[model samples]
Target chain A: MSRIPNAFAKGTAFIGFVTGGDPSPAQSEAYILSMIKAGADLIEIGIPFSDPIAEGPVIQEANLRALAAGTTVDTLFALVRSLRRTTDVPLVFLSYLNPVLHYGYERFFATCQEAGIDGIIIPDLPFDEKDELQAIAAAHDVDLISLIAPTSANRIANIARDATGFIYLVSSLGVTGVRSEITTDLESIVRVIRSATDVPVAVGFGIHSPEQAHAVAKLADGVIVGSAIVKQIAADPAGASNKLYEYVREMKAALGA
Target chain B: MMADKKRGRFGDFGGQYIPETLMNELLDLEVSYNHYRQDAAFNAELKELLDNYAGRPSLLYYAARMTADLGGAKVYLKREDLNHTGSHKINNVLGQTLLAKKRGKTRVIAETGAGQHGVAAATAAALLGMECEVFMGKEDTERQVLNVYRMELLGARVNAVTSGTQTLKDAVNEAMREWVSRVDDTHYVLGSVMGPHPFPTMVRDFQAVISAEAREQLLEREGTLPAAVIACVGGGSNAIGMFYNFIGDKNVRLVGCEAAGRGINTSQHAATIAKGELGVFHGMKSYFCQDEYGQIAPVYSLSAGLDYPGIGPEHAYLHQTGRAEYYPVTDDEAVAGFEYLAQTEGIIAAIESAHAIAYAQKLVPTLSAKQCVVICLSGRGDKDVAAIARYRGRNVHE
Candidate 1:
């Protein structure tokens, strides 16, 4: 073990998203910067593709807008190059493995590391099929974060024991979307995951507001607010710098940061 | 390639269009298949099961009275209908079941059309104490009664798929979606030589034993291979098997007949070979009858077993290659053939097999008088009587 200390230090961290080249390449960098100022400890920049199987309608629609705006590998790398100027918030590229594989895994890890990316989250690449890819990620010092679900127990342990950074615990069985309330069953899922490894367990998939984040943060080491943050960005797609900062500040306060 | 050999084609069909996730897996499978194809270890395993369990090497009977009446050429029936489960479906099922057990899959998932494949898979799952879940079209669950009972008796939970057209297509969609989620502990025990990549190759290899055994039996009895071989095509397993060994022999003509519920001119038919277009459904790219938008059109067939929207990708590739000639047998002709075999030969043939019998009738007349033709009477008709009787406008009560 590299003795990587406890992740993000309890309630002080929040992860946000910026679709690569959203609206245009310039606007995407602006949105990511605004999110960082609003107290986000990490950033997940999505590389839009034609097919995204694990995504729900919201992200899928957002991706379509980004694709229409002429997002490509060159544009994405340029945007990431721009984001590294101000924030040292551990940035990560989140996507299905296909895009990463297409970008070439070793090259992707190297480029992202060069641009100061922390890790990656690929929803579909299970741990069982990740040895060679994991080795490549390790050689580049990029942690490929593993996702766990409610039904995943024994397998979650396998994932948790092997995964670095933090364990992404999806709060529900369904795809990512806005939900009304967190269920009690999530406690058991968190319990199972916490038992597996000492890595911080971050709960996501439905935390829309600071209240929701605070409730989940009581059990999980971190809370992920995706759809809610994305929804704020959608309201002012061209520019929402103030709204972005305001939303993150509320989430940080709710988490008692 | 020898006589009757498709030279890697099925009659004139079978090709591979797949993703990178499966390429290595398929190559591994092909390596195993090639290494074991002629190996005594593989044959001994297949042979032992066929003899001790499935009661295979089933009889080759001469339907003398029917042959004399139809005239033109002598006819022989390879009795696959006499296999353990009253059908040839068990042969492939047992083989794959053993393969799954060996592969260490804790559970098995399958998609079924007429439910014969479901019953066969469930039987294997029950016998081996492995978990099994079968996806059946909601429409088929209502249509195939005895098969539903048969599968339940074997302890398989049936998922009635409601997506798409709510038939075999939907069942296949649901099963594949489930397989995508549970590929770790589960083996998708494909029913036929259809679906995406490895399945087409794997199912064909397992079922090829049918024609392999039939070839030896034919040689021992007639001193040579039969002049022609015929079988029905659904996902085309029976058709593929009865024709596989003959691929090496050039003189023997192998024919696979598909169902045309009405005339090929009518939309109410499963003549995928004749009328369907190019599209991917249930995995591999095959001939499918579709509308302008590319969604699969509703397929129709008098036989539940034959009512599929797309031909197996291999069969489509074969049709394109011209290694096997594709013919469509109409519902009227198939029904008449079913009764003709039942009343004449005293063996009830499945509605699916009726298509082959219908083709054999037409083929016998076209061939020279002394030519010998073998029709693979693929399944027994006990399960199909109600559907056939209803099609004939008769009440089961009477």
Candidate 2:
């Protein structure tokens, strides 16, 4: 496996997610730059899928908005290629399997390599089906990040054993949405994941506020905030940059302390 | 056509392409299905319910009048329309609901298109004393108001989905989203032979009783197999059921009629097999109406039940392997077929099932007199009368 530089090595990495082309590609690019400027150690750009079953209403709407804006895989690759000229914040793609399949797996990974994308996280592809895409992803030096869920009690170690770049620790049992409480016994899950691999585990799903991020950061190597950032972009597309910057700054601060 | 348990595949189609949050639940469900599928007690209970409750062993009525009118092939109709709840949907819901109870799940949720599956699920939940909820498109709830009311009367809550095209596909997306959160206590009774893994395989097995019964009845009456077996395809549940038992009978040509809303060439159609690309949606890798961007397009059909963007993975497999032939039937032809069956055979069929009859009308005319065609009359037309009346510009209420 060609090892791409790991962003989780940065202390308490604060990752921000935004659906590409939410509002417009230009505006979304600006939003991402601002989040990075505000202290997001890593950036996750969601390639919009028609049906995002793992997401709640907030991210679902964002996907609808992006697709309506005529966003496509080629468009996102072009946008990321432009972003590569400017930033070095470890870039990852979040999308469903169909787009990747339709785009052609080998071409998709080769494009990601050219676009300077370090990883891909397909929510629909579980650990069992990772082998379908893992070989190609590794060949392109693009990590096919694994997600460890609370319900993945026995399968955590198996998933973590082959996990590259980082392991995404799902802090809750449901789809991606803001929640007041994450009831999963994350500590025990994390212990199992840690025992299997030296890869950093970045907790995600349902983590919204600074307090939630801070609470999760204490147990994991990093914290990922998705719907919360996508919500800001959707709530005020015109002024998303400033709002997202402030929100990411606060969440980053929580991760630090 | 049994799918492999580990791969969950019908050839290159049908796999568990879902989020990790729901992986354990699907795996757990697979284990439960494997264990109970062979259990004699489980089979006995399900068989008893199917026989007494859903009215299993639906008649294989030889349509003498239709046969005489066609002047070619002998015609027989598998009367799934005569089943309780007026459709074959009860067969699957009964099987899944019974399994849910076995797993100690106290609640069940499902997605519906034309409201037939919703009504069936509501009936099963009420019978079993389990909480039930169904997600239906807002457009469909209004169109199939009678079925919605029937579901409510049967003690199931119905959620009107307004997302995407506000049709069957969107309802499935909403139900799947809801399922992830309540995976522990609730079982998702997927309506069609679609979705992730066990759902496609399991639902087909339950509905396969249709063909299993038909095969024996046909042999008893005709002393041989029919020349062809036909059913409508949306997510392809009824079609798969009708074809499963007859797959090995190579001479029995398995035909699936897809809804060509306006025409296959036009933007308005749900003919996935005729005009679709291989893509994953709602968990299964199948043929979908997708654009160059890989986004599933909003599909249209006069029949709400056939207004789905994708077909079941097994249907895709069948079509690909040349084991099944799919034809497109326009709305105009389907309406004519609906009225023709009513006049010729004195049977009014669901708009979804009429698509198959429409195609059979064309095919039977070309076949030899000794040949026979068996049509899966998937549901009755009571739920579709109002909609059909509106489409034909006549108000039955008037």
lDDT of 2 at A175: 83
**lDDT per residue as tens, model 1, A1-257:** 22122237545467777667666778778777887787777777887754444455577567767767867665777777787786666777776654565566778888877776677776645454455378888887778887776656556666677778887887764556678986637787777777778887888787787778888867877777777766767788765778888888888888873
Per residue, candidate 2 scores C-alpha lDDT tens digits across A109-185 of 99999888999999988877776788998899999989988888778888999898888898887789899999888
In TM-score terms, candidate 2 sits at 0.98
lDDT of 1 at B87: 73
> Clashes per prediction?
19, 0
Off by over 4 Å in 1: A1-257, B1-43
User: Residue B336 deviation, candidate 2, in Å?
Assistant: 0.3
What DockQ was computed for model 1?
0.05
Q: For each candidate in the order shown, give its overall lDDT on alpha carbons.
A: 0.74, 0.90
lDDT of 2 by residue, B175-263 (tens): 99889888889999999999999889999999999999999999998898999999999999999999999999999999999999999
RMSD of each: 10.2, 1.9
DockQ, candidate 2, vs. native dimer? 0.63
